[model samples]
Target chain A: GESVGLHLPTLSVQEGDNSIINCAYSNSASDYFIWYKQESGKGPQFIIDIRSNMDKRQGQRVTVLLNKTVKHLSLQIAATQPGDSAVYFCAENKGGSQGNLIFGKGTKLSVKP
Target chain B: DVKVTQSSRYLVKRTGEKVFLECVQDMDHENMFWYRQDPGLGLRLIYFSYDVKMKEKGDIPEGYSVSREKKERFSLILESASTNQTSMYLCASSLGGSRADTQYFGPGTRLTVL
Candidate 1:
């Protein structure tokens, strides 16, 4: 069965430190990938995305790296803040499908001041 | 601003009860989806509609049915709610494209079936 999963279930970091969350996807046909952040009591918010043709994409305070050869993805956040503490998910778009995202089990990131 | 809205924030139902979950997108997206978010399981697709009156069953669609009478609205129906159905339901929409596009999500509905 095709599945997307995370390597870590939870992580704790000090404020101002860098945070990295990892994901592994099983579908070789997936070409588009995205990262989302979900805060308490809120829906998941789009963070950043990377295409299969590229290996890296950067955003405001986040970066997404895709390793298609290893079928792995990772999200990196700089200057982690308390507000950055949330559940982060990695999702992949299956090729040939019309915008259907398959998500991975999220990694809970906790930032301590 | 593009927004997806769900009818309920929270719902409680008994086993065997019929459940209705409604979602609307203001972005006029060509595609809409329904998913259940459970701890450790992530978001599992229940169903999706690419156009009005058309739908496709997703990974977990056995106990659920869908209706897309209008382009902006999609509804999920549970013929007989079960305890296993208790989870956070999320609705999302995206512009129709060749590959999976970035989806805008709704607040979500927490359902509890007892």
Candidate 2:
């Protein structure tokens, strides 16, 4: 079955350190990728997004890197804080689909004090 | 701030009962989506609506149906709720575009089917 998946299920990092999360997607036709952060008991919030035309996109303190060759994507959070502790997910969407998205299993990021 | 509100933050229901999950967005976005999140499963699309009275099935639309009578409101209905249907349901909305636009989400409705 077609699916998107993450490399790690959980990650623990000390505060102020940088964190990187990776995702693997199966759909080669996917043209857009999005990263989301979900805190406990809350819905997923958009962190950043990248288009297939570009390999990297940067937000305030986060960056999204896309590797079309390997069908992989990564999200990097700079100067992680305890507030950043949450599960992160990567989603892919092919333009031809009916506005549907394929989501990965998610990586739980823990920022220790 | 764009606000997407789900009617209930928590819901408990018995098996075989009909369940309705309501979502309303204040952004007036053209696209609305319903998804279920579970441990390790991330977020799975249940159904989505592009415009009023328009809907499309998503990956896990088997036990779900949707209603979009108006632009701001989208509803997810579980015809016959089952224990396996217990999960966190999330609603999101975004502007219609070639690039599956950035979505704003509601807090979520945690459904418990017993």
Report the number of the highest-TM-score candidate: 1
Number of residue pairs clashing in candidate 2, backbone atoms closer than 3 angstroms, sequence gap of 3 or more or interchain: 0
Tens-digit lDDT string for candidate 2 (A23-101): 9887999988889898999988889989899999999999999999999999999999999998888888856655567
Which 10 consecutive residues of model 1 chain A have the lowest summed lDDT? Answer: A1-10
| Candidate 2's TM-score | 0.92
lDDT of 2 by residue, B14-106 (tens): 999999999999988999999998775677888999899999988899999999999999999999999999999999998875557777899
Question: Clashing residue pairs, candidate 1?
Answer: none
DockQ of each: 0.56, 0.44
lDDT of residue A113 for candidate 2: 100
CAPRI-style grade of the A/B interface in model 1: medium
Which lDDT tens digits does candidate 1 get at residues A1-113? 11235343788999999999999887898998989899876789888889899999888988888898999999999999999998888889877787888788788899999
The alpha-carbon RMSD values of the candidates against the true structure, listed in the order shown, are: 2.5, 2.6
TM-score of chain B of 2: 0.98
